[model samples]
Target: MEQAVCCYRHQDRETGVRCSRCERPICPECMVSASVGFQCPECVGQARPERQAQRPRTMTGGAVAANPRLITMILIGINVAVFLAVQAVGDSLVQDLILYGAWPPVDPTSGVAEGQWYRLLTATFLHQNVMHIGFNMLSLWWIGPGLEVALGRVRFLAVYLLSALGGSALSFLLANPNAGSLGASGAVFGLLGATFVLMRRLRYDSRPIVAIIVLNLFFTFAQTGTIDWRAHIGGLVTGAVVAFGMVHAPRERRALVQWGTCVAVAVVIVALVVVGTYRINH
Candidate 1:
């Protein structure tokens, strides 16, 4: 009767085959075939040293890859940098003085004093305090990656710029003649709004995002400290409209339609600003 083959590593029974690297008898289970011959578990471990010696020393270079969140961070950095530069050149009080902090109706009598016409858009990027910019940037950091990945850079930028414009326009329309406001909240809100639409279209779970947006809206109206509810509302509405239009438009007609829609929105916003300016001046 033939004896049963045993594992060479175990050494409890008859030899099945010899280890390839080690010429030792191995059971079928323990036998490991290598290029030269069957190898035992011990031989495999020993071979690792030789393999390691042959491999390249530097597994990865020192250069770090950029994280997707970096873009939003860079933007926040630029804003802070600008603010710091402003403070360094002028008094700390000057930061508040020039902050896109102008009211509507360029005050013809006062000769459009202090707040310049360019501030409408510029102000949206400025923040009053560290807490203000910090929170806004935090929101951008949390939400930007997903939107940027989904929409690609160009569309994401468009959404942001247009939303900023929308927010500024709303502020122009609804703000008190003398009230001045500045912050990235409007554009941030627009990003939230756009993401909300995109997520819904992709059939992603949007309940959490929707809840966040609603809460922000509630806070916009509920909180009393320098919140520009008009800008928030305007950005929200404009972002949703732009997102809907972008997503729903026919693919073949997307470029033409989007450009046309943007132009039309711009015209309307410009018209509103002009009308408001005239009203304030007259």
Candidate 2:
């Protein structure tokens, strides 16, 4: 019977309802309230411009997605997957992916010095300890979605990656060459910083994020032996700068300024890495 078939508009959706006029199977979303049963979307004849007008939009000029948290969830999943893989493959994975300066004082087999520059980005995803991954993922879940919503996926992703790179670059510049680090802490801190900037842009109360940042900073200093404070501070600073351009750029020239800001930040990050490496090797 018609009731046993799938919806014509949404094949994946099984439904018993059929359009009164078209007599086609219809899902709830495609069904329009009518005099009798329900009319299919096609029968109602919604205008193209009307549908377009109904589309959602992000605050920063990106299209609002149905699932606002999708990117955040994906990031968390990747972090968790990497954590589990580490548990299975062994601790060596951490060394392979972690951000570190030159090694052996002369003969470097691994690290950024030996042309393993991918570590700058890869290190952001590696996590060995359960507590470490747990905390970072929690922070990401808490901070990422809202920023993602405000900035939209592409800009949000740009900020995240730049923040990660910024964190890695600074860590390599200052932290012990041998004392490398790994985790999503940098990206999460970026989101925190972006959140603070966005709150200011939207004229929302910014005190909450500030309080959280202050608390995290205190812990960073208190646990200097464990926490990579350089990455945290670097990500925070980078995220804020990137987000400042995102929310403040003029309407007519927004795209140019926003992307220009990212490119400029990236150049600065590269310069930091180069200068830091030169100092380390010298």
Give the candidate number with the greatest TM-score: 2
User: What would you estimate as the lDDT of candidate 1?
Assistant: 0.69
Per-residue lDDT tens digits for candidate 1, residues 96-130, read: 33232125445542222333456566677777677
Q: lDDT values of the candidates? A: 0.69, 0.84
In model 2, which regions exceed 4 Å deviation? 1-54, 102-110
For model 2, what is the error of residue 48's alpha carbon versus the real structure, in angstroms, after optimal superposition?
Answer: 2.2
RMSD of each: 11.8, 8.1
Instruction: Tell me how far the alpha carbon of residue 100 in candidate 2 is from the true structure, in angstroms, after superposition.
Output: 1.5
Give each model's clash number.
5, 0
Estimate the TM-score of every prediction: 0.68, 0.80
Q: Name the runs in model 1 displaced over 4 angstroms.
A: 1-71, 91-116
- Candidate 2 lDDT, tens digit per residue, 1-282? 444689997899999889888799999898889878899877778545677777876777777887889988888888888888888888788878878654324444346765678998889999858888888888888888888888899899999999999898888777776677788888788888989999999899999999999999999989998889999999999999999989898888989999999999999998987876666567
Worst 10 residues of 1 by lDDT: 56-65
